[model samples]
Target: MVDTALFTIRDERLSLILTRRKDPPFEGLLALPGGFVHAQEDADAEAAVRRVIRGKIGFDAPYLEQLYTFSGAARDPRGWSVSVVYYALVPWPLLEKNTSVELCPADELPALPFDHHQIVAKAVERLRGKATYSSLPAFLLPGEFTMNDLHRIYQQTIGARLDKASFRHKILEQDIIEEIPSRFRTGAHRPAQLYRLSSKTLTAFERKI
Candidate 1:
């Protein structure tokens, strides 16, 4: 199985977590965090994903899902190999402060090796769809955040403008989050309510959608 991490824009710049190949084939090229499945290992895809993320990126991912499998005969340069891709959601602030592999932003990324570019593009498309139909974007949010913060994440992930009133209505109607009684006073405007994601509510919301 192949494990991939989808890193989003952090501080106004798009970025993804990748690793430099240490061997032949795609040596020296940056690619998503993943590796081939080893025999006698757990057959669970999620387990394989966690192992790859921790081994390659040096961090444990909290959210992951099976993406797709690429089995084209000529896809792999090492004779023939099938890849079972898995997608991981990572928040910007959760990244490690120091990394050896060049963590270039999306716009400045150099040419990638193999079919990695195609894999990244497909993972992004899947994220956009999940953002619209599920509470997946919540994975990108910090433990606590404001309504505005959530709105901004949604806009960035889905690449669309959302009406303030409509967005608020839908979120509240879904009841997937709880507004913390404490208000954060950041600016001169009225204090906005802080919210915490509710596990029960999130499960219900996904089911409803």
Candidate 2:
């Protein structure tokens, strides 16, 4: 079996996606979106995850990464089951207008069915650790955003306050984003220049930010 822990930023908080089970074992209980791997159709664990997410959520995740494998005689009631786990990061805009799954703040999760709570914790830990030195949190924002938007997402994901000047300097020095020429978010104060990711792929920084 394969399971996915989908994450996104909502209302300035890091959030996770959950669905209620409809069948037995844990009927009506909240669980991460997942499904069994099809022997013939799925070429690998990642392929199974993509197929499951597409079928269950009706959209493709922007960023997905393999997390860990969990297996034990008692992890599942069905017995001797092993689960290949994956975590996906989706931009809030991508889910805002498309998905109807329940969104829960990652820090205040209730009891989950199976060992899903452990899976979630592991996923969050990985994301936060990576955010310290990579452009991982940028995947939580829309394609185009201002520096302030980027800053807020990073703070939320990292769960820490950053000095604005230092944060901006670090981000600019990393060269992960490129300013959209002549584009600015105009408001009462000076317009903020808009920028976008240099590439859709994730970039790792040589030094921690």
Who wins the TM-score comparison? 2
Top candidate on lDDT is 2
Question: For each candidate, what is the lDDT?
Answer: 0.72, 0.92
lDDT of 1 by residue, 1-209 (tens): 57585565576554677888888888888777777676679577667777888876577765777788877757768767677788776677767564554566655667777677788788778777777866777777777788888878887777677887778788888777887776574678987778878762224354322
Can you give the lDDT of residue 6 in candidate 2? 96
Q: TM-score of each candidate?
A: 0.86, 0.96
- Clashes counted in candidate 1 amount to 0
Residue 144 of model 1 has an lDDT of 79
RMSD of each: 2.9, 1.1
